[model samples]
Target chain A: MTSIAVPPSAPEHTGSRLTRVLGAATAVSWVVWLTYGLVLSPADVVQSESVRLFYLHVPLALSAYLGFTVTLVGSILVLRKNSAFWDQMAGAGAEVGLVLAGLVLVTGALWGRPTWGTYWVWDPRITATTLLFLVYLGYLVVRRLDLDAEVRARRAAVFGIVAFINVPITRYSVQIWNSLHQEATLSLTDTEMDGSQLTSFALGAIAMALFTTWLIIHRFRVGWLEYELDRSGLESAILERRGERTATEVV
Target chain B: MIAAVAGDAARIVAKDLRIERATGVITTQILPFGIVMLLLFGFGVDPALQVRGGDRSVLAEVAPGLFWITVLLALLLVVGRAFAVESDDGSLDALLVAGVHPAAILGGKAVVVAAELVVLELVVGAGAVLMFDVTIGDPLHLVVVMVSTTVALAGAGTLFLAVVAGQRGRDTLGPLLVLPAMAPVLIGATAAAGDALYGAGSGGIAWTWALVAFALLYSVAGIVGAGALLEDV
Candidate 1:
């Protein structure tokens, strides 16, 4: 039997092994992070075990905020001066932000039940986050607009920059009105957690930061590949179209 | 010359009005639909009271929110329609470069949207009172508050529209962007309405000024934003 040719100097794995490797990595990190977050971290004397959820909620929410911030910078750059790099970065940031925001929604819902005796409340903060989520969702919807690719990119860039209004509102909503959601506990200079608890959280947050950055790198590569596919398809289509145009002209 | 200027502005306003009357947009549709929704809720489809553990009464405390949500939905549907007429004729670009002050452009459109809001609030309010049996403490103040708040909401919305009208994907993104910006107005208006329902006259007054501030902010922001971005459009 002919042997399957293996590429030299590259690691080889069957399809199943690849997934097993990923799952193993995920399980290891998940255990380490959750252990640090749940058991090792000291519970707030006031909030008790309920505060454990902060391990997920705060990191997820802050990551989401950072995503939008990155998206804003990218959008402004792209719109002010047309550049593919900015557009790609914006796409990357938005995709990551959407994931983090989704996590925030789920984690917040999980935390709400124990604290508020409900899964969701229409408090100003919750409503504002929901609204903010809708805006990111809006960006995805706008991305689907049927137009020239460049036109769509430019239009989406403008929309991204403008729609970031919700970012500030989502952050300040608790202060602006009565809301069930608590104020942020972590400031650059001040944090409410004890040292050990803070250490565990800092570790989990650092892990999340690593995961997010890695995910973005992968996502950007995927975006570049997809763009390449589309570009090749467009070229072939244009060639066919041009040939038709000449035939019609001659006729 | 003054007569001609007034005539020109008036003619432009009339054209918008005539076009609006001709094409019944999503706003006109959503208004009746919102009323019907309130009616449906009142017909005992769901408990509309804040007393049944989580009642959130259909026509009192939550009533103000329901009213504005209905207003917000209707405005969402209509605001995009404002630019449709000019865009269709390809005249929006020409209109921007015609040396007419952008204020006049936004002001004229604001008037139209304000009028629409008044008419819409009347219908939605009447439906709430009739179907859900809402109580009105001061009918006159309620009327004033509703009108003023509607003006505030529409002013912000239309101003945003003027700035973003010609851009790509604006039809969808306009509402998404504006609703967040309108939260302060919506919150203040709803709070004022709630206070009046509870016999707190002074809080109502306090919230009224909030509406005025929002309106003024919308006006200034909208005008300056439009002036800056007009060249791009």
Candidate 2:
């Protein structure tokens, strides 16, 4: 039988010094955002308390878009370079983006219940975002398919590019379709922000961006470890098979 | 280069059409499935139900959505079958080994799916008309929307079908991937077809343009991305 040596001081987690710093920064910004956004900023005249949700909702939406944008760039890089690192980055971007997009929908719905008098409407942005979420959901499913690593990455990269192109086209079509049917009764961007409100929003956006970056970096590391483990496992299995063959031959 | 690609694509399309002709799956199975879906929509919407605040029946008013949804569902089968044959016999791998450009494969498959969908749409459109008793307000608009939407659906569907070609549980995954990607097609086609059939003046021409844009966009994506997607399978 083949024996393997274990490292005495291997890191037990995906975290590193940069991630630790990012984690601390994200935590500090969130605390600051919570203090200012919840207490210091004034509410809207029309939307009143519901306007507070926009602090999280808008930033979350932006982060979601940014995450998917990372996926798009990573996917392009994968196709151009055919590197496993790029594939891992693409997958991490999509996983993080899908979570953020899901949160955006939930926050939007929770905010909508109070402001729009309905939990959901076929508003252009909302519809397009929902479809975008589903599109990435499909991407994730493709990523999970059982296949050879290179084949899987190639397939996923192509899908990521195609799905990213779909977002703007979806938004445009939904916009036109919405306009043809009825006038938009409420728009998400109609809020008028004062100085404190703007500061709070800006803070929240920065915090969310930092947090999203932290999550994606961690996720990418985790995916890299997983790929390494899979490769090592295959190597050991092959080694074990060779060892068994040698033992039987000696017998 | 373009000519070679076109030649390969033409040969593939011819081969697929020959297989389809021999099997009669589209006519015998898929076409009936679409018509039956139209019937099911009629039953589900209730034949006697009238539209709210309108003189038309509810089914008549919603016939466009139902019709497009049926076409979309049927398109799944068409696409699934298109690639299933290739994958089942390992012909996809053979083709790749034979050096058929992936773009040609994509183009050929998409064209065949679009052709099948057009035939399905015509039969299903007739079914909707007979079952719902709706009048065609603009034949030209209807034809344009149908053609463009069919092409868009085919392009997106073929690309996604390629994505899921040899994967497990692809039967379900195929729709999961294709439907959301093709949502814009459903919306644009439904709105445009409604205008064509009911003269609702709901920017049918503009919606037609949207469908055309979708068609062109996916066609380009499929042609460009298929090579990467189908590299090994």
Candidate 3:
């Protein structure tokens, strides 16, 4: 289960209970999403069975947005407190967010192909989403720069905050530009969804949200463990080098 | 404190300007690059074909977009060069420890960039008129659009410079990072300029106002966040 090397003595029980519960919840949520996509919701009117893509697509898009938002919050805290935990959280969130964002773009294109008769358009939402994806991908690239962990975290934090600042502007600009894409059917003010479709959508959204949270938690934990192991290994190596020098001098 | 910071910033700007003047880098290097880009754009638009038909409307329509895109490219070059200059000869470390406020450093660099962009626009604007036979519907509106867009690019470019200066392959990565973020500004500026050139009334003024807002937003972000970006780098 450990993708990263972890010390055997590292406390595994501190959050074990929460992890187990979340694991079960994640499993349940995936089931719910699949069931809703396959059986629960009726086919859409204009889109027909292709509207099932909506069940998968919207939740993933929302999850990607939620992940980036979490990264933004973590970055803000990282800057404020300079905490390693916040750094790890931000990195994990961005990594997962990037993957989900790519999926969002792919799913969007797939959905567009059937609905709009083309796989691509310079529609504002698509443009903005593309920009969002690029910006965070740049964020992850910044994190990979060859610097000390502390320095890297600080740099990535600054970028993280800056990138988030662009999100709203990107969204607003795209919305401001005339879009060929259809107007949103689901929103706070009004929703076209009704009866069983609405219920299934709600379930899909909740399940996706839960699944997203579980992924982030697991990613962050793995990252924390990796760093901890690195530090310990570095300390032991330094001590062994000192011992070797003393032994050579005595001989 | 403000005066002291302003004084330091002025010194940095003066130093940078003096270097540009002595080296003639702006006139010799950037000017040639801008002209070449204008030539390529003119060829791409193929204004010669339109002129033979006695209809210059298509040329006029594409003129603003072509102009702003050229400026965006020029802005990217200048921003990359400005930071690259600091990284050369280990001056970035020197500048950091020189006891100057980091915001002042950003302010100094931004003003220099804004100045350079003014010259770039003049050259690009002249080329567009001569090559495309473009007409300006509202010179005043165009000036407003140009100034605000220049300032917006300056502020945001400085911030992005700081973000990528220390990274490897910064030359390529810097543009990659800045261009996507600058997408909105590009859209707004192009729309406003297009509106000013062809007298497209709808949403033109609004887009111009958005450019002004962008200028303010980027300047504030750069000024406020410069210290954090420079810290421990």
Candidate 4:
């Protein structure tokens, strides 16, 4: 919030006017979509009002996958090209993806209470999503180790890319198992959803994705600055230590 | 580069096998914990030994599940050990500098983990069947379930191991990391064994076989992908 901290003329990507515009667009779209979904979207015939969960669950799940995909792609860059920028992207994306996955889990549980009459079931999709969340959490936590930057980044990058096993697992687990969860929105040889409901789902997913990409970019920039600060601090500390040793000898 | 990589791979695997053979120590660290878990499940949960109302069938159905739970936890135990072993001995850095393929490192570690799991599951499975009065209708489904689950678990676990090998808290974080990813194996094996114990009746083999294949496919995909992506890691 401080102009000094941001340093308007200090050779930094202080985010263009375009970013600000997109940010506002994202907020407006979210409000419109959430309100339309909550009040206007027609309820499912079988589950009545509870089916309104499709909005929260599907969008959140899609966003989580999108975020994780970014993490995966960023990690691939970290390993293939040894780019720290990609590492920062992976770290931030994992944390954000984990958050979205958590929302998906909570909303799914809430919906489960009405439809399945239980707060929890070992349903395939739910279980797989939970697993995916844990994997991302592991990736995030493991990166916190005090190791060389490349070492930490490369290790976590491998993890982000490898943990992608859960993507398909989450998408297909319900279909694979005798799950209590409903089938996917898009299925092979079958149409699972239609009309304004699908339209709403599509719009909400796009909005969430734009919002997610924006968050990831902002987070990556913050990480870059933080790394810069840390490197300078380390340099100063080392120089101060050398100065003190020389002073002691002079005394 | 490929041939050189293959040569190093062969050498590393050979060294690992010789070291393992000499020490005869593959996952001994997790053995104590695995034993405790099996005992707790047996004495605490199934102590009554009540076979009434087809509970025997249920226990038999759950037999394969016990091994998976054991495998997941035990794999968690050895993750820190696997990575810590390499780092403590400075072998990981040496290997990295030696131009050895990262896949070779993963494959070597995976072979050892697979061996440990196979041995661990055997002991644990025998103990469960003996203690719980469990039965099996077909030995082949049991084999498929065990092999597939073990492969899937070790593949997934070792992938995490490579990622977290340099970090702290790997000891506690390993199991936590392994479980959610291991869901398909748990459910698939449970369903397979449960169906077999309940009579292999109606939709049993088909569904169980399908899940096993799915687990295998995922595991192979995960292992190959991890091996490829973990190069600079």
Candidate 5:
């Protein structure tokens, strides 16, 4: 159990309160969603049982994007304000985003295998999504660099900003190149969703967003504690050496 | 301010050029490595087989993609060599403390690498044309695509190299970070160059414009973001 030292400037109440609230809320939401998704929702006319995968796949994809967006925001804050809060947020958001993005890839492939008759396709959407995943994986690599804390934070922040800026470019270029996937089934302009499907989807997305937030907060605290622990260890080691020298002199 | 930056950048470029010239790494190392890559690809593909298979010219069709792929691979070596020159004997520290803006350092480095890439492009492009039998129907368009792609690659390559500079295994990590990001550049440049070489108006001209956008985006981002990165040290 690593303990976080609350700095004078930090908020007194941060990790535990929010963590418990979010954890409970996410659990409840997941239960509601599972009931709605599995037991209540009607099967699709064409795809039947496989369509339920949609609830998981789409919300996970959206949550991954949300996670990265938070990273982008935190990265901007890090550069603008030189805030450690933002740095922790960016690092944690990136880790969470990377995991969710990976899950999106896995779930997407599983969904595709059943629906599209193959596990992988070079559809433009798939290509862009994979590129997004790779870009953030690179972000994680940057974060893992063995450097001073400040230097690492600054470098990762800049990388995060640059990577986020490239997302639209990647999406546009892939679209221009070509797409083989079926036309988008969900959108504001072209598609309409009925009551139960919309309700279930909204519930799932909310749960996912809450879950992402909860994980980021806990991870940020862990990072802060790690830094504090390292500094205290260094301080105590120096104190021990000084004490040893003083006792030798007394002798 | 701009003039001061330009002057400082010019000095850095001159210093780098002098060092590289003395070493002849550009001529002796990167150039040969690029040429060998071309030869290996040519021999492995064996355009002769395509010709026998009744294709008009498989090498010609593949020429643009092969050219960019070769350039992309050679780019990794060029970036590695450039940073290797900087990371020796506290030179990087000296530059950081020189009171010059970090963007100038970035500009200088990008110019140096971009110039090297141009030279590499000329030599390797000539080699590719000869062996791959690539015909340029529109040299002007080809030049545009090449220039834009070069700019994009230089900007992004320099930025990423700087980002990974402090890492231990940066030699390997730099390429891992850069290659995927360069995918759009690769796709757009290859497509536009294909149209230029083959005279195929297969809507690839649009990709050339995308290349231009990519170049500007990368260069501007590198310029704006590099100062903070350099300050991190």
Candidate 6:
């Protein structure tokens, strides 16, 4: 289990009762979501069967937004406090957000093909989302740079703050240009859902949110362990060198 | 405090301009690269091709976007060079140690870059007009869009340059860091320039305002954030 040099005090794995329970809830919710969303929900009047992708697509998009929000918040806190925990949180959120955003694009494209008669269009939302993805990808790239951990954290934090500020500007700019995307089906002041579709969507959202949380928790643990391993590795290397010198002196 | 920052910024700007004048890298290398890119774009667009339903050639129609794209590509190089000089000689560290505020350093560099980009735009805009036979219907609109876009690009580019200043593989990483952040500039500038050069409508004014807003947004971000960004660099 301890394939790398980790302190014995470190947790053996990135799981606990809470994650396991969340994992189980997520699995059950997904199962219910699939049964209802795929099999039971009536086909859309306009989209026909293709609308089924919404169950996954909308939830994934929301999760991606949530993940990035976490990143943005984490980044802010990191900058303010210079906390390692926030740095790790920022990193984990970006990774998960990137993955989910990728899926959101794919699903969106897939849904667009049959409904919009093309795989892609320069719709305002899609274009803005694509830019958002690229920005975060850049954020992750910065995080991966070979630098001191504190330096990297600071850089990433500054980037995260700036990138978040860019998001709304991007969205508004594209929106002002033109839009083929439909109005929001789910927003603070709106809900365009029927009973069955709403139920399935709510379930999917719960499932995805739980799953995203679980993944972030695990990812955060992994990042924490890596940090520990790096520090411990340096210490052990120094100790080994010191021991070798002492042995040679004795010899 | 504000006066001190402005004073330091002016000195840095003068220093950068002097270095630029002495070296002429922008005039010698970056300007030529922009023209060459314009030529390459002309070749790619094929001067013979015309828009399907319009009297104008395809090149004329796309000149605005192509012009801005060329500017953006050149911007990556300018930003990389701007920071490269600072990081190469440890001058950036020296500036910090000399008690120049980080915001002033960022502002000074951005001003030089913005000025250089203005020159690049004028030359490149002239090149596009001559090569593509494009006309400027609203010169005022065109100038507004260009200046705002340049300021925004320079501000964002300088901040992002500071982000990757001392990192390894910054050449590759710089574009990855800066370009996406500039997407709105690309969209707004292209659309606004298209309107300006084509007499499309009143929409050019709106887009210009958007560009101005973008400029203000990034300038504020650069001023407020450059200090924290460069703290550990």
Which one wins on DockQ?
2
Candidate 6 structure, TM-score to reference: 0.92
State the displacement of the C-alpha of residue B133, model 3, in Å, after optimal TM-score superposition. 2.4
- Compared with the true structure, the alpha-carbon lDDT of candidate 4 equals 0.72
Clashing pairs in 3: none
Interface RMSD of each: 4.4, 1.2, 1.6, 3.1, 1.4, 1.3
lDDT of 6 by residue, A89-148 (tens): 999998998999899899999999998999899887888788889999999999998888
Tens-place lDDT digits, model 4, residues B1-233: 66765566567657766766676655455566777787777655553444546546445555667766777778775555556667777778788777666767776666667777788887777777787676767777777767776776667777766665655665676665667666766766667766665565535576577656755664555445554435444
lDDT of 3 by residue, B121-190 (tens): 9998998888778888899999999999999999988888787666678888888778888888888898
Clashing pairs in 5: none
Cα error, candidate 3, residue A238 (Å)? 2.8
* Predictions in order: chain A TM-score: 0.79, 0.88, 0.89, 0.87, 0.85, 0.91
Error of 5 at B39 (Å): 2.1
Q: Model 4, range A68-168, lDDT digits (tens) per residue? A: 98898998898788898888888878878889999999998998898889989877688788888887887787678667787777777766776786787
Instruction: Judging by TM-score, tell me the better candidate of 5 and 6.
Output: 6
Q: Order the candidate numbers by DockQ, best to worst.
A: 2, 6, 5, 3, 4, 1
DockQ of 6: 0.68
What overall lDDT, based on C-alpha atoms, would model 5 receive against the true structure?
0.81
* TM-score for candidate 1: 0.70
Candidate 4 vs candidate 5: the TM-score winner is 5
Greater TM-score among 2 and 3 belongs to: 3
Evaluate model 3 with DockQ and give the value: 0.61
Q: Which residue pairs show collisions in model 2?
A: none
In candidate 6, position A137 carries an lDDT of: 98
Cα deviation at B12, candidate 1, in Å, is: 4.6
Give the per-residue lDDT digits (tens) of candidate 1, residues A7-104: 24323322245445555565677688888778777777866788788787877777787778878888788766776667777888788988888888
Worst 10 residues of 3 chain A by lDDT: A166-175
Worst lDDT run of 10 residues, candidate 2 chain B, spans B46-55
Native A-B contacts reproduced, model 1: 0.20
TM-score of 2: 0.91
Q: For model 1, how does the per-residue alpha-carbon lDDT over B112-181 read when each residue is reduced to its tens digit? A: 7777777788888887776655678777667667877877777777865654566677776777667766
Candidate DockQ values, in order, are 0.21, 0.77, 0.61, 0.47, 0.66, 0.68
